[model samples]
Target chain A: MSDPILRLEGVHKSFGPAHIIRGVDLEVRRGERHAVIGPNGAGKSTLFHLCSGEFAPSSGRILLDGQEIGGMKPAEVNCRGLARSFQITNIFPGISVFENLRLAVMRKHGLQFTFWRRVSRLDNVTQEVEGLIERLRLGHRAHTLASQLSYSEQRSLEIGMTLASDPKVILLDEPMAGMSQEETEYTVGLIREIAEDRTLLIVEHDMSVVFSLADRISVLVYGEMIATGTPKEIRENPQVKEAYLGEEVAA
Target chain B: MKLRPFLILLAVMVLLAIPWLVSSSMLNAAIQMLIAALFAMAFSLLCGQAGMLSFGHAAYFGLGAFATVHAMNAFNGEGLLPTPLLPLAGAAVGLVSGVVAGYFSTKRTGVYFAMITLALAELLHALAPHLKGTFGGEAGISSFRMPAWGFGFGTAIEVYYLTLFWVLLAIGLLYLLMLTPLGRLALGLRENQRRLRFLGYNVHALGTLIFAISAMFSGLAGALQSLNIEAANYAELETHVSTVVLLNSFIGGVRVFLGPAIGAALMTFFGHVTSDVTRVWLLYQGIIFVLVMMFLPRGIVGELVERFSGKRPAGEGIRLSEMLPRLAGIAVAALGGVVLIELLQRVMSRDYRALAAGGQWPEITMMGLSWQPGSPLTWLVPLSALALGLALVLGVNRRAAARREATA
Candidate 1:
């Protein structure tokens, strides 16, 4: 690749005794949809956490567009054009869907601590929030409380919140965890629509979804990268079959 | 734009008319209510909205009051920035103190946060008396008049109007704050601090900002109180005062916007009535508190509004037929326990007055019941009554269980 937008070099992390993310090194070019897939407890989520600045690496470095972001706070990382949707739905629950999106827009517009002016009356913010709501097909539910939305609707709102920041890179953690087949298809469409301009790094458990959406796949086992290849190459790898795909297929 | 401002205007007009319709003593009482209302609202911002239960709110109130008093003295009983603007001094001092304390306190959450605030307040209480130069020691500082501001002549009625204006302004501003993004985030922080952190918002900064705003309003109240009463002392900063404000907010329904204001008004009214009618006013307050906690946890205004909004089921008001029996049972149990404990306490003392004062070898006699110090029979009635009360409670529980099972 000409110049990767994100690069992780020998990232390490541990939770007291249990070592997770032993040494994760990966790179993502601009507008590339990279997928990280592994069995449960294989540190796939932990790697995302480290990449997004939710967890500080025990050692090594994380670089965003050639600038090191290792040990930076989540807010600082967010300001640098990297944003992530949580594994669990983590949008503001009490606020209306409109307000939730407005907050993200406000942050992007550098209005986090402006207290004198009323936020609801800001025409620019309201316009942006309304536009995002229309694009996400949440215009009907704009006034509804975020908590009152259906499971799939909330997942879509989560992605919408991440998009509101106008990020260069989007990190999605299992965007279709609890969705029905229809909901999953709808979300995959939304993901594809979003991936047109943004660099995407997703951690997913569903192999079929991974194969369909990912341009490149990195397989992890026991906190280490076991293989990196195209979906067809990964499906055909004998070692990967014995280690992960075999058990998944047998189940 | 239309409804919120109209409501605010209506509230302001009603408050402005209070002094003209009531006696001076009543106006005095109203002023106290306004101050208490402001204090309770500040408490709610931290406790109800932010899920931070502070046991040291009086520290801000007292600090503001003291600062106002000192400012008044410094200005030599003249309005330094007009009497209407005097509250800002208190608010400024409060903001400084709140920020200083909030820096360390926000590092911990939940019970540890409560404990830290409590300890900090207690430390201030201890320091207030020793800082005689500024705090005026146990005597406290007193104010006279502020040279009548732009309204001319310093009268109680004028002071009342000034207080009413400030109260309405402060409450209205707080209401506006609740609709802001920062305010919404504060509520979200209460629900899940970790989620907020992941969303790339500084949870600590949000908390500190809320704390500072709460303190600023509290200080405004304290300043108004000092101007009205013409005195600020150590009593204002005591733990008991903080608890009183907290209780009032909780009793009024912390989550409701106007709940704390109504609660403060009711409490002030209760204080006036009880103080006039009986020496043991605290006992009456305690009894009312227990009753409110057991039956109306949402607070007086909260429950009334909830009912009016049709949130409660139809026909949910207290039914005389259903309530009377429960009331009778509770009355009997409470009386029995009180009598039994009193008897036991007297029996351990020798003097009747001493027992009433707190059992220094006292004796007891009331309504043909008497007990001598060190008598074994003195222990008998208390132990028996306690056992009987436990049995009655258990019997009630069993009855409830049986009813539930039958329905099931």
Candidate 2:
């Protein structure tokens, strides 16, 4: 199918009196890095939540590989080959970094509800978790509890878990929120490498990372997508310059 | 690591030899301890591993007991459910009830999840008496242990072996289950239920399965109770049954595989020994619970493991010289507190009040000594002990901190 890997058509969400996502529309093609950028309260996170099934859209359709996924349960959305990371670090804090990825990878291996086999003895899963830890540069901290990891390491774990499922589309919600400059740079390179194979939908506040990493950028303003274009096209877009990118990109 | 399995085997052998070493009455108490240990292990699966604090596990345990009793009476313990396999009846009933209750309870999580379990158990307790045929009414159901597999199961020794056999097998299964994928997912459920959803896991379904499995083992424990006593009582469904298992599991350190079992066995043995002498056994149990939560939040076995886990630097280990004084202080404080509680209990008793009507405070004999209740010495002695204990503990803490700083 030639359709975009993830398509959001005229999506709208409202909480009683609050219209958080007001008729937003976007598309993420397969094998490309897509970034969604907007000021605070522009409904960027809400849009991620909508696509991720944290909240059902009040209206409109979300299609993954031309299959309707809007309003589906998170597990159902995930099984359809879409996985996401939270803006706030969401991980199994009580367990080791290796176990967290194993939990993520085990589902793909059809190990859900398996009671007879020991998880430690599942050689493929252990290997996959080890490979993920190495790729995230967290092999040294593999057995440490997720809660004990430094903030940046925890973020890497979150991304590592999201990627473990080998999903067709991956959504990362401001993964670099609390990361240091060096950490962010390392993560930018990491994300770019991972995005080489899978479709990525990321919402990042760091302007330089977004501009440099995204193959296509969607500028959201006031619950609406004002512009969607390549990096060079978005850079020169006058309307985008006025609404969200103001002054920072101009300099 | 190699010593671990050898130790377990040696412990099992010791348990196997208990019938020869202990009196029948002691063996009988050991039977109760085994049953209680099994119950607590079942509970820890849901509470410690899955992180669902169920306030009404007695519902499953009691259901299992009643089911086993009915099975015994129906088959005369000779057919499908022989003396050896009777717990299967309890297991089946427990699993069914667990699935039904877990479906509703797991729909809401945390405090709400706990409330649903409590409500369901309370509902069963309320309705149990009305269901005369099933629950055997107020008097409950009684059954006789029929001979099966050539063992009469007629004496306390026989019953103890029976209970030991089943408890070991059930506990063994539980340990194996913890090593499985489902077992690891239960930890994930406790760690972060929301994250499991995005990881392509049906969190609610997983919770229900775990809850049912826990209830299944609990039912087996109840079955053992019926086999030991040759009866089932509605009294098994009481809230105290639920609370005791919760307390015992927490005390044993639910996170450890055998922690709850050890906690339950230890507490049951203590209860059997002290219930006759002190009416305040439960109060002591409550106090121990509170103290464990405050001072050793990991519970008895949990705290022990943490201390010996070698996670800290070798130099950080408490020296015997430093620990001796602290241990002595704690023992003194405990003895003093027990004496005080016993004295206060006797003083406040209606019998004591009647014995000493109007201005006459009688001397109460305890611990091979007579103490006058109205005397200053009585209050002063225990209070002094408590103060000294507290001071010693605080001093140790301050000293440890200072030593650490000096070393740094």
Candidate 3:
């Protein structure tokens, strides 16, 4: 990769005594669908946090499109064309679904800090939010409060919020967690559609979804990347099978 | 939505017509009510809309009042500025101080935020007497609100109109602020601080901005008070004043924009009436606060809004019918309550002029009618009226619920 969109070099994070991520060195090329799979407590979510600037690596460099974003604020990182969704489906629950999307769109257009003009009168923002709502198939529930939406719908809104920023890189932590099979299938399709022109990095548990979606895969285990290859290469890699995939493959 | 502008117009007309309808003293009371209402609304901007509960809001109001007094004095002494624009000085100081205080206080949220505000307010109150130059000692700063722009504010009524003008402008501007992006984000800040941060917003900056805006408005109210009374005292900065504003906001329903205003008007009038009737006015205020907290947790306007939240307006006149029976029940209950309270107070004090001459049977004047304190009939009438009013209230409530069910 001549210039990877996201690069983690010797990244290490520790909470007091316990080292969450020992040293993670990874590179994700532009427009590639990269998925990181790990068992429980492998610090997959923590790595996402570091990459998204939620937490700085204890000692290493995190580069987003060649700029070192390691000690930067999440907002500054976002402004540099990187967006992420939480594993816990973080969103503004009190506001309407349209308003949630509109805030994100406004933030993208450098309007979050503005107090002079009414947000409701911003024609482009309203149009873009409407377009996003239609694209996400959230039109039926556009006026409903974000909290009132079903769990799957909330996740969809989260992803929609991430997309509203129009980042060059997208980091998703467990996008399909706790979703019904139907919902999972729909989200997979949505993610695939969205990932066409963006660098997609996802941390997921669903093996079948991973096999189908990831253009390349990195297997993280015990705070390190044990393997990184294509689905075919990963499926046959002996180390991956012995370390993390054995139980999943058998089940 | 079309009816909203019409309703606003009607409200403005009524406010304008109040001078013609009421006596000058009543108009003075109305001026006080406007200032108190603005104070409450300013508090609500932070407490209700931004999810920031400030306990020492009187700090801003006091600072504003002091600033206005100084401005007025300057206008009189050196002609530095016009009397009409004195509130702007208050607003400027309030905004500056609010930003300073908010910057530190907003670092910690929830209970800590409330505590920081309380501490800041107490510090100002304690220092006021010592800062005799600015605070004017315990007696506070005094100034003459001179006539400006050919509008002679020599009379109380003229001053009232000026106040009305500023209050209307302040309220209108505050309402417009709610439509802005910053205002929307304030609501967002209240709901989910972490989420806002994740969305790339500086949550601290937003909190501080709202704090400053709220303080500015509060200061504006205080400046209006100085203009009205021609005095700015240390009492304005006391914790008691802060607590009263909090009570007014809560009772008005902090969640509703107009809730605090209604609550302020009610508390101001109630305070006046109770003080006129008895010396234990504070006790009466406490009881009302407790009752409101227990039963009408959302306050006067809040409860009404909650009841009507899900109901679409089928017709305008229909709401009046629904409210009439309830209002009647409330009126009766209030009348009964007031009569019983006054009679009991009179009996307990026993310091009435008629009973001062060692008379066993005290001649009590209840609503201009003579009553013998020793007579059983006197006690029975109030007690029976109380019971009757309470029963009617209960019956009316049940009917209202049944009607709601029918409509649903």
Candidate 4:
């Protein structure tokens, strides 16, 4: 494939004595949906954090669009067209839903430090914020304080905020966690719709969702990826079956 | 659509007319109130808006005061800037002090953060007395109010008007700042610092910027005070002064925009009235504090606004009927126990022979009981009365609670 959009070369990370990620090597092509799945304690979240620059790797490197991005701060990584959504909806609770999207857009438009001018007077910003709110199906709740929103609505708002940066690569950390079945299906559809034009790196635990949505899957066990393949290939692989799906398949 | 600005203008006009109506003493009081309001607003921005409670805000206030005083002294020989520009010097000094303090204090969070600020203020307090030349020892630095730059009036009213003009300008600027992206980010930081960092914002830098702004306003208030009083004393930097500012802000309600201003005004009025009426005003002040903490945790303005607007409470509200009786009873009992212990200790320490020789207390009769102020029995009576009062309250509270439970 034309040069990978993102490449992780033998990335290693550890917290104190616990070696969480042991030499992870992964790659994603442009416009690809790459899902990373693992058993508990497999360091899936740690890998995503490393990719998003929340934490630096112990060793090895990460590259985005053929440029080295390892060891950069989360903000620097974000400014370079890489956006991340938290596993547990990190949003401004007291402000209106529109304001939350506006913040991300303001940041993207390099207006983070524009203190002298009133934010409400930014016409183009307001228009863009309205459009994003409509696209995220949050039009009804536009003026509602974010803390007042339902859980599923918050997830949609989180995705909307992530999209505001117009990122080339989006890192979603368990976007479906605490979401009801209806919410999950809705989010899964939203993910597919957005993934058409941009690269997506998602860490999910639901195997069925992973199998159905991911273009390619990487299974991590004990901080090490034991399998990387299509759904069929992963299901049929003996090592993968023995390590993960063995009990479910047998039952 | 534009009624708010009209109302604000009307309010400003009324405030400007205050010196025309009120006495000079009250005008002086008003000026002090305006300065206190500025200081309280500065404190609230850090404590309320940013969720960074600082105990060393006096550092900036004192720095600003001293800077203005020294500037005034220098102007007597060679004028560096206009008198109106004195506040700017104070602002500059405040910014530097905030940067220095924030660098060390922002390294920690929560209680450690408060402790570090308190320790820094205490250090400054100690240094103020020792730094004889710069701080003017106990007497403090003073300057003559020479007429400069056309707006010269040899009256307290002119100074009050000038202070009112500055207060309005400073508050307006701070209000505008609260509506900015940086302000919103500071609020977000207060809610979730880690999340803000993860979102690619420099949480520390955001905090430092707000700290600097807070210090700038605090310095402005200090500069105004120096102009009003013609001196800057070590008392301005004391921990007690810092605590008073904190208490004023909290009792005023930190969350509301106009809360600090109202709070400063009320505190100034209370201080003036009580000091004039009673020598034991601090005891009354302590009692007011306990009552406020028990009943009106959000302060007068916060509670008033909530009552009128019917808005959801910012904090959990306790039903007074359930809590008040118990609280009052406990307070009375505690006071009684403390008094009883204190009286017993004093009586044990005193020698009867010495008391008689001193002619200290053959002296007083009240309600058919003759006793000296120095008599152990006289002190014991008050302590016993306090104990009786507490016991009665506790008994009533228990009976009430049991009755309510039974009715339920």
Question: What does DockQ give for each predicted structure?
Answer: 0.45, 0.88, 0.65, 0.58
True contacts kept of each: 0.25, 0.88, 0.64, 0.50
Of 1 and 2, which scores higher on lDDT? 2
Better of 3 and 4 by DockQ: 3
Native-structure RMSD, model 2: 1.5
Each model: TM-score of chain B? 0.79, 0.97, 0.88, 0.78
**lDDT (tens digit, per residue) of candidate 1 on B1-408:** 467679767877888898788898888888888889988988888888888999999999999998888777775566456666778889999999988888778889999989989999999999988999988887988876566435752677888888887887888888888777777667766766765665667878888888888888888889999989888988999999899998889788887898988788788788987687545567667777787877788887777778767555545555555445555556666666666645544443445555556635545565476665568776666566556655666676576567557766
Candidate 2 on A1-251: residue-level lDDT in tens? 33599999999999999998989888898888999998999999999999988899999999999999899999999998999999999999999998899999999999889998988888989998888899999999988999999989999999999999999899999989999999999999899888888899999998888988898999988899999999899999999998877798889
User: Which portions of model 2 show Cα errors greater than 4 Å?
Assistant: B76-80
Q: After superposition, how far is residue B147 of candidate 2 from its true place, in Å?
A: 0.7
Which ranking of candidates, highest DockQ first?
2, 3, 4, 1
* Stretches > 4 Å off in candidate 4: A247-251, B1-7, B75-78, B313-408
What is the clash count for each candidate, in the order shown? 7, 0, 0, 1
Query: Which digits, one per residue and each the tens of the lDDT, describe model 4 over residues A47-140?
Result: 8888888899999999998888889988888878788888888888877898788877777666655579887787888899999888788999
- Higher-TM-score candidate among 1 and 3? 3
Residue pairs clashing, model 4: A75-B200
**Per-model TM-score versus the true fold:** 0.85, 0.98, 0.91, 0.85
User: Taking the tens digit of each residue's C-alpha lDDT, what string does model 4 give over B249-323?
Assistant: 887888788887778878877887767754455665666667677777888788877775646543323447755
Q: Which stretches of candidate 3 lie over 4 Å from their true place?
A: B75-78, B309-340, B343-408
**How close is chain A of candidate 2 to the true chain A, as a TM-score?**
0.97
